[model samples]
Target: MSWEESYHGRLRAMAGDEEVLIMVGARCLLRDDQGRLLLIRRSDNGLWACPAGGLELGDSIRECAVREAWEETGLTPTELAPIAILSGADTVGTNQWGHTYQFHITVFLATAWTGELVTETDETTDAGWFHPDQLPSPRTANVEKSLALLAEYDRTGVFVAP
Candidate 1:
């Protein structure tokens, strides 16, 4: 099992099933050389989102972004640019075993990447490149924020509070 699963299991055993945990995660707004954004359809909810995952112990935030991008979408991030830091009350819905979480996410713009497009079927059902204006419906909050941050960065070369 993943560290997150093991940690959550231990936490649930100690604190009960309804406890809220604060998680720190990393998300990557990966883009191809053609400037198309890469989005993955989550296996759990089937909503499109940028590649992301919770950080494991001893992992740096950038390392987590690189690892999550490759794990979920098979894209090796070559360059990661800090886009924004998003923190708030975002519900991470219950797991199959009914464990819920809240997360503070660090978002990055993967400006350069390599490797063929492939989806990790266990975590993602679909992965594809889409134009910014042609994104799929029902985007995850992180994805929406990433896009907005990218737009703002492009416009002013700065990412301000939204």
Candidate 2:
């Protein structure tokens, strides 16, 4: 079953012409002192992924990441440390809408966290902290990339390069 059959959501971004490209989204890398990152089991596909979602209208990309993180994990990130800017063809949700050209995503390393992680949200079912090496069992491709980016940031503290 494709993402389209799994999720009834839409992805639209201001690219070119009048058509809104429905492929852009954001992902957040929240890590703790133990080097564990936050992950949410998506309610729609049961796949583990970083606390992330699509960018809505009238929302800055940074704000969108923060909002999606909070909504999905029920935790507030205090700071946003730039990690890596990922650009590539991405299939938003469960839809196979002919992967769009490089969905510009700004990955971040959030060290400070507040509130409690809850599973009472509609978007996410389960939430937990896992070591980078011991990530979840069923994580999305983007989740894997996000984890790699986090490790890269940890090693160099530089987000631009690999």
Candidate 3:
């Protein structure tokens, strides 16, 4: 078998009998009134992704999302109705070694939050609001999924995948 297949098989074995191979993490899609989404530049990897991070011990996913938003962009996110609950195997993620990988992600679409737009922390080297139609160059793959969830919210006043 190929290296990736073998690795996946091992992971599957490691997760034996469990439905999901990983725990839940948190993410937030913070949008401005103009339909612009806030994105962060990670200091570690320097990739532009939505202001998000993994959950800490004893922290709820929503709390993790809000905290990550603040830590990265210096913006306080107000939790709105949940936008989506995405579940799958092989959900890709990145490692500290710059290796490509996968994880299950729980994404949220928050409508209420407060904070001026400013760079405040090293967790994110830069922060900016980008129009959905004019997303920054080299956007991450998951941005499209977030945007699709937002669009679904706009169309149905709820987050139901089409």
Top lDDT: which candidate number?
Answer: 1
Among the numbered candidates, top TM-score falls to: 1
Candidate 1, number of clashes: 0
Q: Write the per-residue lDDT of candidate 3 for residues 1-162, one digit (tens) a residue.
A: 332354444665566534344545677988777878888877777777887666665678788888778877777887555677666554755455434444556778777788776664767677788898877766677788788877887888765533
Total colliding residue pairs, candidate 3: 1
Clashing pairs in 3: 93-101
Please state every model's RMSD to the true fold in angstroms: 2.7, 5.3, 7.2
Model 3: residues with Cα > 4 Å off, grouped in runs: 1-21, 92-102
Off by over 4 Å in 2: 1-22, 89-102
Which ten residues in a row are the worst by lDDT in model 1? 1-10
Worst 10 residues of 3 by lDDT: 1-10
lDDT by residue (1-162, candidate 1, tens digit) is 453475545665787778877678888988777889999999889899989887777889999899889989888899888777777665455566776777677888888878888966678999999998899978776677788878887788775444
In order of lDDT, best first, we have 1, 2, 3
The runs of at least 3 residues in candidate 1 whose Cα sits more than 4 Å from the true structure, single-residue gaps closed, are 1-14, 89-100, 159-162
